[model samples]
Target chain A: MVRNYLYILTGVLFLYACGSCGNKGASGTNGLNDIPDDVVNLGIAEISEEAMQGFVDNMSSPVEMAALIKSLNVGYSNKYLAPTDKIEDYTTNFQQAFSLGVYGLDLGYLNMYNKTNTVLDYISAIKTLADAINVGQFFDFTTLKRLAQNNQNLDSLMYISVHSFNQMDNYLRKTNRSNLSVLIVTGLWLEGNYLATQVYKEAPHPALKERIGEQKIIIEKLMIFLQNFKSDKQFQNLISELSSLQEEYKNVSITIELGEPEAVEKDGMLTFIQHDKSIVNISDETVQRITQKTEDIRNKLIRK
Target chain B: MRPYIKTIFIFALFLALARPAFSQDISELTAQCAASAGDVTYLKDFPAKLDAGTPGGKPPSAKYSMLLSKNTAYRFTICTAPDSEGEAILDLYDMNILIGSTYNKATGKDYPSFDFKCQKTAVYHIFVSFKEGKAGNAVGIMSFVEKL
Candidate 1:
């Protein structure tokens, strides 16, 4: 009887272990479904979804941009953010997804300045847009609202808010809605750049200027991803609009110099010192042109 | 016979209780790891649950591609799950080159996290794995340190 009981217990453990193994398999390609049937059938050859995902994934987070702006002592301004009242105007999934990105960046900016009071408006807007796109499950609005109400939990709020968006993006890509994912990414990039450029117009910080110029690399990659979905008229229009902005970026030059890598172990933490340095050369004239063109493109996208 | 049945029932109850308790521990572990990132702005989290590979084979690892900007300081933090026996290591690579790692092989030491001051605007890869091909679960967090 003892032996029999032991056998049963071992069998139960084996099954439990097997249950955990279910997650291992080929990654689902639900994202491919987002591609238009025409593009797939016509053999126009869209970039692999995985490659596109990599492009979207690598874009710098808006929070980083907001943090840098705050670090430069730039005062928080609501003028730079897409107005929350216009959420209803974003009827189309394209517009909603794009606006979601815009508001997401705005939320980052607000959080950076510790403007928790105004955060609820943006959070509501984000939740509405996310729900419209069927990715609302990722955001816990209740907890976010609670966190936003308390300044002490700013770090937790930031982490949860960023994590929520990351989870939503992953879900969108995992499902077949990468098209929306791309738009969100583009929207975030546009808003982040817009905030930086607009602030530079007022403050004119050199670090901020160089940061704006660095978008030359980012826009190049973003354009490639947008071009992959050029089969759609919306994407085509975006590509056309961004092409002008991309042209403006041509004047901004960036070059890198490799340096010896050094590693330091301090207080049980490893720090890898990057020796490579990049030289960004952008004239004020070019920045002005980029700024004007960024405003133009961003306005067109956000306008009702 | 009754005693044997009681013993089996108790064992089953323990198994049911342990699963959720372990899951809760992992959740707490992940939260603690995220908190350990300090005042840096959180960017993304990479959750990896990996099993040991074949004997004498390369250890399993999770790889994520990130677009790191030029002149930006980024921090990578790793935390092993409570139930895991293996300690997780994170490696940052630019293409084929290994640029940084949490563990220094020669010194036989492991660090909880590492900071990378990226100098180029390009796509980089991060790999997370356990030492010596051991099975484990861990959460890797990437946080923005500052603009360097």
Candidate 2:
């Protein structure tokens, strides 16, 4: 009897472990198989869907731009942010997802500047948009709101807000809603660029200019991502609009010079100082054109 | 009867020990990693779970590609799951050349985090793997430290 019980128990444990392993394998795939036929049937051969998803997943966070702006001592202005009142205008999933990214960047900016009062507005707007897209569960609004209420918790607020956005992005990709993820990313990128360009127009900081010029790399990447979904009419229009922006970016040249890499260990932490540097040769006229184009694209998208 | 009771107890012990390895929550692990990021502004995270490599073969690693702007200081911090047997090592690479890593091969040391002062505006790769190709779970967090 003892031997029989042991055999049965081992069998149950083995079956349970196997079942868990099977589920992990199923979820590990990019969910390409579960994607709707219309979505994946398009000729997306130039870049594999997984690669595109990875690109989208790894794009820079908006908070980095906001932090840079704050570090530059650029005065905080609510004028550059998308108005919070327009959330209701976004009815389609594309609009909501994209605007969610827009508001998320704005929230990051507010959190960086300790603009506590306006933070809630963007958070609420984000929550509404997140819920619309079925990703609201990631937000933890009550905790976010409480954190936002205290200026002393700026770091915590920033971390939680950005963490929530990352979670939403990850969940979207895992469930095969990468098209929506792309829209959210585009919206965030457009707004961040718009803020930097607008600030550059007024402040004209060298670091800010170099940062704006670096958008050439990002816009090119975004254009490729948008093209992957060009079979959809909405994506087609986005591609056409961003292509003009990409054209302006062509005039901005980035050159890389390789240098010897150096690493240092201090207090048990390793630090790498990259010797290879990139030089951005962007003409002021080109920046002006890029700025005008960014404003145009941003206004058209947000206003509609 | 005594043998049967002992067998049942052993079985329960095995299940208790193995459950955490399989059921560890990635979000919780990621939060722990984020905390290690300190006051730097959080940007994004790369969470990976890799199985051990075959004996005498290449160790498995998870790679993520990111665009790092010119003249910016970014921090990369790593946290491994409590139940994992491996220590996570994160390496930053440009093209095929290694730029930096959390572990110093020459010194045989491991750091929980590292800072990369990126001087280029191009796509770079972040590779995370376990020491000795052991199966493990880890989250690598990229945070903005400053603009250089």
State the iRMSD of every prediction, in order shown: 5.7, 4.9
Candidate 1 displacement at residue A130 in angstroms? 0.6
Model 2 lDDT tens row, A1-304: 6776767667766654554343342223333453345544442433465765467344556777887888888989999999978778987777888899888888888887889989989899999988777677678787889887765577778878988888788776666577778888998899999999999999898888988888888888888777777778878888999999999998998888889989887876678998988988898999999999999999999953
Taking all chains together, the TM-score of candidate 1 against the true structure is 0.84
What is the C-alpha DockQ of each candidate?
0.37, 0.43
Question: What are the models' TM-scores?
Answer: 0.84, 0.85
**Residue B81 C-alpha lDDT in model 1:** 83
Whole-model Cα lDDT of every candidate shown, in order: 0.80, 0.80
**Over 4 Å off, model 2:** A1-49, A53-58, B1-24
lDDT of 1 at A230: 86
- Candidate 1's C-alpha runs over 4 A off are A1-49, A56-58, B1-28
Instruction: Give the least accurate 10-residue stretch of model 2 chain B, judged by summed lDDT.
Output: B15-24
Clash counts for the predictions, in order: 1, 0
